[model samples]
Target: MNLKTFLRGIHLREEKELAEKSAIRRVLPEGEMVYPLSQHIGAPAKPVVAPGDRVLMGQQIAEPDGMISAGICSSVSGTVKKIEPRMTVMGETRDAIVIENDGQYTPAEGFGAKRDYKSLSPDEIRTIIRDAGIVGMGGAGFPTAVKLTPKNPESIDTVIINGAECEPYLTSDHRLMLERPDELIEGLRVMLRLFPKAKGVIGIENNKPDAIKLLSEKLSGDPQISVQPLKTKYPQGGERMLIHAVTGRDIHSKMLPADAGCIVQNVATAIAVYQAVCCSTPLITRVMTVSGDGVNTPCNLEVYVGVSHQKVLEAAGGLNCEPEKLISGGPMMGTALYTLDVPVQKTSASILAFAHDPVAANPSTPCIHCGRCVSVCPVHLVPQMMQVAADFDDFERFEKLHGMECIECGCCTAACPAHRTLTQSFKYGKASVNRLRREAKAAAAKD
Candidate 1:
């Protein structure tokens, strides 16, 4: 069978076998749920319910504070214990809503009731997604409503479902595709309603033959939807990379997928959309892959949002021992967690515990100027040049080298013989450059 893949991506040990076969099981939150206000990419949600106010499951507790923000819904029936600072998986503390789960998950009126999407207008559908507090569950955490409402929906000719789940050790999306294939399709159909001209395609990596076969069989004889199996490769699920591989399209740093006549949603995100639009169920729970050699049992759990990482690890039969390394998301692109106290948010994909910390154990040495870093970059940027620009504090040189375009997929660092921290350098450079730009913009406004 002919397969599709992007160029210049490194091939690593998939490491998915650890948890891919595990069926999804609901892992209820046993402790107080801590809902971070700034869970998505835009402005943090504003609390609408005060402390001591009683809330039910699926109740809207917070409202969007800005144009690009997302709303927040309570996942359990309880009293608003307090609004306080809480830590997230990224090792940062932000103001959050602390709810005392009363054990009885009482649903709000109209919650979980079935609704026909066919009768609703596009605007109504978009409003439903916004109210459900859905975001890009595959890791980006961008508000799903904002993604659905592009500037020019008419230009959208292809709607892509990102089922690749290409990140190592992350199988939440893989399981979602297998367990809820119909719901996934329904969500895509919901999206196709907004862009009546667009045809939907689900892109799955060939690594998941079971998922590909299942979705294909379910979608048999469908005119507007089909499944396309991609060649197994790291970062194949990256927004730009997947768009390129599936549709032969290219989008740069300044462009959105809509600019390329496409819009993409994650496997779990699509299923959530279906639930929100059809069943009136908010994004309260999602599948998470908790696996690695450090954990005694590897499993895909449907965990409540705002559940602590500590509780999640326990739900997975606890760690085999104290892990040398712990990460949120996947090994290639996930952030290292300093503490297990961090709460899972809408974008929480997986919790990885490793008995061995390879990167830290093998300290970085001076770069040997091997061109492998240059060759393996999916975006075709030169890592060595970007590293020099980053090290020398030359933002202009870094921009010229396309440092901003780096997806930070850890490809260059993985390909380097010298074990350099190339991805981290680019990340730091990108943040610093953005800060400088914001300062410059402020100065111009004063003038």
Candidate 2:
């Protein structure tokens, strides 16, 4: 089989052996659960329950505040203790719902019973997904309902299911693909119902041959879907890269997958869609990987949405030693945590703890113009030039150079011999450009 791949991505040592073969285990919270309202990439959900109100497991505690937002559901049977600001994995405070677990584990009404998905119309399927509060489970956290209801649904020709599991040390998606291939396919079919002309493609990196074989064997004789193996590389699961690799379609920076006659969904998100449509289940629990050199035991766990990271660490058998760094997702793009008190959200995929410092203590030096950053950049952006523009506070030059096109994948930084923070500089440069644009717009409005 000829494995397809995008150009210009670095290959890192895949450290997924610790949890890749481990089956998903359940982790229940022993104390109060924290549900942050602004977990997804839109306006925060509006809290519908108040302090002291009883909420059953899978009950909606908050409703979508806007079209782009998703609803918030309780992952445990409990009473609303309070609704206030709480620290999150992003190292910022946001409004969160504190629920005191009653330990009953009672299921909410209209949940767990499987339904006939074939009888439901496309509109009905989309409605169920929206009400279930499903989002992109691959960590993007964009509302899935909005993604499914594209403006030109009929024009869509392909639906790509991302199963690459490209990030090192993260095997949650890998385990899901191996154990729940049926549900994943069913979810893809469910999405296909929304786009009648679209065929489904399951893209997996060649590193996971088991998943590829299982999905291929199960999908045999199915004309609408096929399994495509991708070359093993970091960020192979990126939306644009995956689309280009699988369909030979290029998604410009300002355009969406819909513009390319495609729609990409994560493997776990596809399963979530299947559950929401067939089981009437809400997006309350997710499978995540807990692994690193610092961990005493590395495993894939199915955890509730509001459980704390500290509890998860304990469930993973605590740390082998004092952790020098804690990250909320995979090391390449995941955020470093300031505190373990932050709760898991719907998009949480992995929690990594490292005993040895992941960063080098050596100070950054001047770029030697080796052009490694330019060579390895998946998006073809010049990280070195962007850094220079940012250092000079030249937002105009940064914007003109298309600094916003940077995906912040850290590949340039990883390939940098000078250990310069190329990705970080581009991030700051983009923020500065956006700020300047907003200021100019405000001034024009005032005029």
Identify the leading candidate in terms of lDDT: 1
lDDT of each: 0.93, 0.92
Model 2, runs deviating above 4 Å: none
The residue pairs that clash in candidate 1, if any, are: none
**Backbone clashes in model 2, listed as residue pairs:** none
Residue-wise lDDT of candidate 2 within 25-85, one digit each (tens)? Answer: 9987877999999999899999999999999998999999988999988999989999999
What TM value does model 2 have? 0.99
Q: How does candidate 2 score on lDDT?
A: 0.92
Give the lowest summed-lDDT range of ten residues in model 2.
Answer: 355-364
Kindly list the per-residue Cα lDDT of model 1 for residues 293-343, writing each as its tens digit.
999899999999988989999999998888899999999999998799988
TM-score on alpha carbons, each prediction: 0.99, 0.99
Clashes of each: 0, 0
